[model samples]
Target chain A: MARQTHTPSTGKLPGVEKCPTGIRGLDEITDGGLPRGRPTLVCGGAGSGKTLLAMEFIVRGIRDYGEPGVFVAFEETADELSRNVSSLGFDLDKLVRRRQLAVDHIRVERSEMEETGEYDLEGLFIRLGTMIDQIGAQRIAIDTVEVLFAGLLNEAILRAELRRLLRWLKDKGVTTIITGEQGEKTLTRHGLEEYVSDCVIFLDHRIVNQIATRRLRVVKYRGSSHGTNEYPTMIDQHGLSVLPISSLGLDYGASTEHVSSGVDRLDAMLGGGGYYRGSSILVSGTAGTGKTSLAAAFIDAACRRGERCLYLVLEEAPAQIIRNMASIGFDLGRWVDKGSLRFHGVRSTLYGLEQHLVTLHKLVSEFHPPTVAVDPITNLMVVGETAEVKSTLTRMIDFLKNQGITALFTSLTEGGGPAEQTEVGVSSLMDTWLLLRNVEMGAERNRLMFILKSRGMAHSNQVREFRLSDQGIQLRDVYVGPSAVLTGAARLVQEARDKAQAVSERESMARRRRELQQEQALTRAQFEALHLKTAALDEELHTLEAEDQTRRVTAAGEQAELARAQGADGNGGLSKKGAKRPADRYARA
Target chain B: MIAKHATSDTELLEEAARKAKHQKYVLRLYVAGMTPRSREALRTVSEICREELAGRCDLEVIDLYKQPTLAHREQIVAVPTLIKKLPLPLRRFIGSMVDKEKLLVGLDLIPRTP
Candidate 1:
């Protein structure tokens, strides 16, 4: 029966066993860390930090994971190794003194020794076994294993001994790290160590454009998944830190809780109180565009909430920041005295990118602040090259995000004040981006604020005038008119013109009302004159009716005497006929 | 003629001086395993030491397989390396030790070839 080999091609199989490296950002890429209880070969050129990495593994294993380690140095003496790494905050001597660690230096001088043997490194095995038993070490670090076989001339014997040693390490059930010198064409000078080890990691130091950068790559990891990309590894006082270039998939949770920007109007301009909790905010602007002022407002708000805040000022001292913020009515000295705010300042040019990152990590772990503000992160570009700066910032942001700390960073722009020109080129990583510009509309320049984008929230699109006064920072609505959005003195002038136009409209309305009143009075006088003429006509009619009645009465009396005479002379018919005939004849005449 | 005579006298004096200073030599032969070449080298070196120096030489043969510590301490890189320790100028010869003349020359026995 043929035995089949289990080899993973692409991704990690669930439940693959591993050991955590305890180094920041390294465990994330390796899923957990190196394969447990297997030998790992680390090959690198001179000054590529292979020895440092190996030593870090041993030291971190003993200090952090409580796994006792043995360091067998072939090229460097134990004392030398300890001295070289004392600055990295590793007390190697103390660990050895406490019996938790062991450092063995194997000295082999080529000019004094002779070999007439069929040997298989049994002597080395015995020595290492004694040390391992002394501390019950679970991890072992061999610095430059190639040095032990430097004087051996037989290739076959050397290869056999190397294979035997690796097998012995595996049988001992100890996780081991072996350092080697990079060969011209092979991963290691011995060329066979890579095959015998379970995992191989390569480190490279390159100088491009007068800038030095150290990078690390995981060449192979048997039976496990690991980040295959070349990650930028930085070594400083804090030892080695590997920045995994590839994003550790989107596994972070977003917070719906909003924190105030400390400026009420600005908060209203943003859809709500402020940015989301545990989000990264970027405030980019030209010089003197009040970028620091905005950052101070954020810090003040965080401190006012009784939350601890850390202000990392890469460009200014803590005293200078406090003094400047005080002039703007943000009395932060009280916060500092109350232990709510802490300030740490470092010149951007004082250290390399890795050292700065290490310092930041150290302070953050010690302070444990809920909110952090990095004033003018753009200044860090001076210490590192473009790629270095980006990788370092990426790792730093990832760390802060994982810690669930609200982060705010300020960047300085040059002539073109648009916020799109993020000089550091990290706009994509920010959750909220606020762009401030110097809107030069009049003889003086006024500060203007615009929200470029706010991920997962609605934000204002109108540009507002950002005002800084003795009271505090304020956001006032700009004068938007037919032509353009006016600000500063231009806004004041536009406002005045609007007021004058309103006054003129009111005066014209009053004049129109007086003319309407005069026209109504003349119409009323004409109506009264017509009423008097109608009353005179009514009186004349009444008087004529009375006269006619009286005439009729008098006539009736005369007629009564004549009628009585007529009646005596003739009958009723003759009176009627005679009266009607005489009347008709008179009417005709 | 006088110059030729002075040359002959100097030659004779040099020979006499070399004969007078014929001290016992201390030699160490280093070999790996018991391979045919290493065995042959051991045999040839011992025979030369017995015949040429006649009990005036001390030859120590070391097999690298048995005692590797000695081999490591001595820093021997190759097999069949014969080290001449006593001579003012230490010399080393690497090979099967079959070339007696070459070995003698390497051991600073050239002037005492008789």
Candidate 2:
């Protein structure tokens, strides 16, 4: 280890005091900066960004830092390098003509020359020495020195020669770097190179599913302390820039007094309208509980209001989220196409968490989006150790805040009880907590969600039934019973019991109606029969009386027909007894 | 949108220089792939140069993709980087080769330049 020591400040007779690496945080990691006058190594494999990184280092030194430099290459010509990094906007030939920089290309080919076993690398030394002195270069980079080992077969001599060259460069009292391709398993093909060099840096390239990740790690530094974790490095037109996740400043961003959550109900539940600008809010819930849909609604709201949004999908693909939430009344795919909504999807385990955090910072910085979101932070945990993930989360949140950007993060909860979930927690960095659970009422199970707590704002505490449909997630007004938050089996049982009870009630009502009808019919029949019998008895009695009177009249008519006929005919007002005979008997019964 | 797109290589550099602020030095560099120590040396030196200078510089970079022969007239022996020209004394940082002390003394950014 290069025991990270401050520069001795020995009043040297040199033309300058110290040279700093323009890369942020690099100076601190190296204690001061690279040694003032030595060549440094930066090596990697195919398409590992070695050439680009070295050029940026030198050109930036000259142009931005006012330090002139000399750039030498054996693989590609200076013109090739220039065209490669044109997008970053660097001019090489002009600097050369102005005597501010010197770039030399040393070509080494297998077919062009034969290497003797005693080769001393004299041409490289002379060319390098000449350029260093000519430009008075403060920083130097040697990209892919592995070719030396390939061109020359004598390892013994090569190691000795390389050691001698490094010592000579060291005697020159300059910070130096030598780059070579990493071996299959070792840090570099010539594994012993680290032992020979003052500082050893390992550059890596890992390809999984065609998304490449380039990283840099300080394997060892002879006189300085460096960040130990593997850091993500990006190469664009600006060349190699390492992402320093640990140094993110959380308290340094500009935050607005007011921030709006896209939805009115969600905002109301969150105290006001979600979080302030430059703040991070985490929305955690179980599967299929509208967590993703809720986030999409927020993104849509932001885009509609002309606030820039970046939606990062770590759990699902962008297309999937768009399609799934399309039914929830979200029109974000249109915004994505219009560029107001930026979507980035990546598997969490594919790269290190630090790298993921770095990429997020890079994108946010580049786009300057007003609102940013990460769907499900759990995936980042899959990428590395728990502590690492936590730190990455902290750093990422800090970075977003420092940028004064509004950020939303969603995480997955294992169970459904809001209280139980609270017990199992992540970093409590959220300003609002929304608890969603499944509650049983009678025989029906409902999705009940509500606001548990919100900082700095008054909110409704009523548990509302959460319903999702074509219109999106809506809070229903009905309350649900507190039945252990109906899970799979309980919900099923409740539904069955409800259906069975309805069936039983219907059957009992039908049986009672049948019994009442039968009793009424029997009473009506008995009353009609009794009335007929009484009428029959009264008719019989009247008939017998009439027969007896007729018999007596017939006997008398035989003796005195004239007298009997006269008497009966005269009695027109016949007795009241006869008139009341049958009628009175029926009335009495 | 990048303004006033310059078509010719020479025109691009001229435009860059003209637009560049005195404190912000606009620079364009051409380099090839990593082959020998020269390329690596150039990579190392430029970063050191950027720091000593601070914000007074701007760099526009281009990679020749291992075809250093295009910049042959510039007498480039290193593949990584070449400072074509600058203010007064012409200087060059060869290869990806970088040394901190050498860079401070060599670039003259500290006590001398100021």
**Model 2 per-residue lDDT tens digits across residues A446-470:** 6666766655677787766667777
Q: What are the root-mean-square deviations of the candidates from the true structure over C-alphas?
A: 7.5, 20.8
Report DockQ per prediction, comma-separated: 0.09, 0.02
The CAPRI category of model 2 is: incorrect
Q: What is the TM-score of each candidate against the true structure?
A: 0.74, 0.57
In terms of lDDT, the poorest run of 10 residues in model 2 chain A is: A1-10
The DockQ score of candidate 1 comes to 0.09
Give the distance in Å from residue B19's predicted Cα in candidate 1 to where it truly belongs.
Answer: 18
| lDDT of prediction 2 | 0.63
lDDT of 2 at A219: 66
Which regions in candidate 1 have their CA more than 4 angstroms from the true location? A1-21, A64-67, A111-126, A133-136, A149-160, A190-192, A208-211, A236-238, A244-247, A312-314, A342-370, A374-405, A411-431, A518-589, B1-114
What fraction of the true interface does each of the listed models get right, in terms of native contacts kept? 0.01, 0.01
> Model 2 has how many clashing residue pairs?
172
